[model samples]
Target: MAGNTEPLSPRAKLAVTAGKAAAAVSRAAGRGSGSVIGGRVALKLDPDLLGRLAQHLDVILVSATNGKTTTTRLIAEALRAAGPVVSNALGANMPAGITSALAGGSDAKFGVIEVDEKYLAGVARDTTPKAIALLNLSRDQLDRAAETRMMAEHWREGLSGSKAVVIANADDPLVVWAASSSANVVWVAAGQAWKDDAWSCPSCGGVMQRPGDDWFCGQCGFRRPAPSWALNGDYVLDPHGSAWPIHLQLPGRANKANAATSAAVAAVFGVPPQVALERMYQVQAVAGRYDVVTFQNRELRLLLAKNPAGWLETFSLIDPPPTPVILSVNARGADGTDTSWLWDVDYTQLAGHPIFVLGDRKLDLAVRLEVAGLDFRVCETLDEAVQYAPPGRIEVIANYTAFQDLRRRVGN
Candidate 1:
């Protein structure tokens, strides 16, 4: 059925938008195919139609640099444990994507969505979610996003005067500042080794200093407090390969942060800590982000590295015994607007591992890998790259667009 089938009235458009919001409200529903907003399709729907569509459904905008997808999925899962929920559990985080996900469901009380920071204000103005869960902010996709400040400003402006409960990461300076400014704020603290030490205070241009767990501007003395619900202990991996102690589903410390954010957001819905943690261990990673599949009796791990930050975070997870790795970089407009952020990703960690480069931009990755002075075998065909990569232990790191192509080539 066409997800957007509605009458031409303003109220009809709003109902359609709310229906899309419903699709996102539950994890059981996959992404509805009707709302494709990335390129030319974004122009398919009229602005008035789109604005009216946003008027329906209880939208929950979950925005962050890293943990958005996992957190969004986890929040939906936790809410489901309590009762029925609708969510855009799929990786579609934009307006059309959220709309598409929202179109499939009939029964849903809540709509949990992972919104793109660039479009957060617009979506907020349209849908007006019940709660805005602001995860930590960091540098990502500099070309399209411009800078962290721009996105932060847009987020602050989009959420102005909304009664949506503000769930924020208190450890992050940008998030803490934004959350503290809101009267209806619930702070979530998390222990992350990599704090925003590099960014200076936006006000007074003074050095940003960590006076305790809390951070303040050395120049302006603007302070942001710690999170109320913080994960302060050591993280132990689950033996079964799930994200935690259940199955080995999610890998890497970054996933742990994702898990922590999920737990905190779940708590906001009154889901018990034990239930949240249990659900977290039970859920599997969504298709492209750190998904592992077996092909030809060999282990192939597919990790999505969209931006420099995501790439670096994945790199940190490679506690290597020198395995063969295949890295693909594709900038299909759906994946991103620019692919130049590869320079910011630290490929040095993979120096010990033999690398195979593929994709439409194979040469770019090869040149970058070579500039880093690492050894790699470059191939134009994904099959050839898979054949030439590590025989028994293989790791494939791909951006969004290249994943399906690689999966098909490797026969998984």
Candidate 2:
């Protein structure tokens, strides 16, 4: 499969030229936010650029509160078994970013793209993807529709407009509820560990009941659907009940869930289950999530913990006690402006571990640590912080911009 190479309309050609120029200037300025800027300017110049560019593309749109980036990357990697694939790597997930990615990868026939939770609908509607992968819904930004049920409603409406097969996490009630209305659905029991925002039924606002792993609503009688593709511990059981063993180079139960979801999505595109799993096994990291970078004579493994649910997953991967960990948090636009979400994180998971708080919002994390009654110290710089950890691997977990900054430092 190959992307359409036909010449663009005069309006689109002019828009692309201007957008490319803007991206070049932005990148030269070293701001690193140029990817979306170009797309924004392009879309402004030609409003229909996204739909125009999406023509003849076998697009897969993946959206969720967490794991969207990794899941998108995993699916994209698997799709390479089919043909050339295009995606906005490392979580550039917005309308502009999606446009920029499609524009740049003009010859890639298939696209596996990550989209922000709020923008999921527009992208799905525009691209009309071959398959839409729904991971899980969680309370990410309280300032911006922190109520995930509402976002689920938005997703339901958006997906209704899309002509795509929906591959959703059956274990996540929010995801199931949102995707249930879709005409074609493939359910995967990709486990949902974070249930803080899913206590109430999105349909009836009734209290939900969980009997073991299955959940049902008390008042409205909503319940978990039997999954077609399921993840049980170390194996992913297919629709025929054949289990395929999966071993990931990345350590974390969340990555296992991500791996299962990726394989499920790949199957929709005719990629064999075993072949998909093998391809996913090759991923050591998605951007900096599990990359080991040597900075100042110390090996630092970067984990991007953008929300409390994300923190919950990554904390389990941290080396217990003795080894020092550096946590960086920032209250930038990419990360929500309000940092109150810190209160929801179970910081006590690292109760006895030696933690070094870093970044501009290090003090905020320190306050949270103090409230949690955990022992922690402050580190001013990454190089100095690298000195504190003993000879083994040092873990550095940061949110959005902080993670992006450190990733750039490591790459440079």
Candidate 3:
């Protein structure tokens, strides 16, 4: 004879216990979603369950060579002001990172993830975002990505599967030409004088030159018309005499572009210009790129100099007369096979500053410093470099891996 009451199975009892445990942990943490790390583990344990949980959220995918992290974080923060948002805010822009972030969130209306160009297609395949922003691409890490042309080809393929509304930088001829194929695209560009780089029309391989601030090709004559949303003038704050000022804690000319691009993305998300401007002003700086960290009676300015483009822009921001510099060369294999890009950077600007070069590739950096006719001293260790660095004014420039090493050594 069967009992009138149903007995709980072993699996059912385990599920109930797990639910109770999760609730307890959530209360203990004093935060919602319990713990994202635990949630990631749970998703890794069961993908089907994770997918079921993530079906309702809208996704936004943001990509670019530079400024992706800052833009992603800014967008996430602005979206948060509007409603609930889940984001991979820690510069984990890979497909695996995105998968983990999405799986970790228990309740969110949307998901924003920055995607690295190398992995953009893979990410696009997995999550079809409602909107996607493609910032300009520059010559960076040639050994890793081969050439800018190859990177363009990758993006050309990567964007095919995207169903989202595409937002692109029109100032970059290559970016615009590559993205023109997308029917639903919004162009966000800077003023005409801002066209300093694109030498050829990606559309027809025609030699292109800037006539005033407008770019036009000689062969195919592909010209980028004025943008729907364009920022004019050199000042990041009020490029067009607007009430909103471009306030950024990040230093450099590149950061101005980063801030503009972030504002464009935020605009698309329905953030009011006033609110977005306020958000931009509120941001002091990201962790590593031009980040200022204070120690016990010591100040450290972490300037990220990954490649020629980054360095050129970064050095331009050191104001009120230049100071002494500490240069840390890249040692990581991923930085690039060829370290010859140093010649392209303007080392002459630091002529007065006594430079202290340190890193695994300290010899290479020292040789470049000498060749550039800049004052320099070689140091075998970061500690030696820091110890020798003048007390009053010293700026530290490091590539990605070297910055990490220096940070660890400096106790930052």
Top candidate when judged by TM-score against the true structure: 2
Stretches of candidate 2 above 4 Å error? Answer: 1-7
Roughly what TM-score does model 2 have, to 2 decimal places? 0.95
Q: After superposition, how far is residue 399 of candidate 3 from its true place, in Å?
A: 1.0
In terms of lDDT, model 1 sits at 0.66
TM-score of each: 0.82, 0.95, 0.81
Tell me the tens digit of each residue's lDDT in model 1 across 132-231: 8887676665556647766666677667788777877767766665565566886666544445433677545678887666677877777676455555
Candidate 3 lowest-lDDT run of ten: 1-10
Tens digit of per-residue lDDT, candidate 2, span 266-366:
99888988888888877888877888888887888898888889999989898887777889898887788788999999999887667888888889999
Per-residue error at 331 for model 2, in Å? 0.5
lDDT of 3 by residue, 298-365 (tens): 67688777777567666776643346678898757757757877767778878777689888888988
Which candidate comes out best when scored by lDDT? 2
Alpha-carbon lDDT, every model: 0.66, 0.86, 0.66
Q: Which should have the higher TM-score, number 1 or number 2?
A: 2
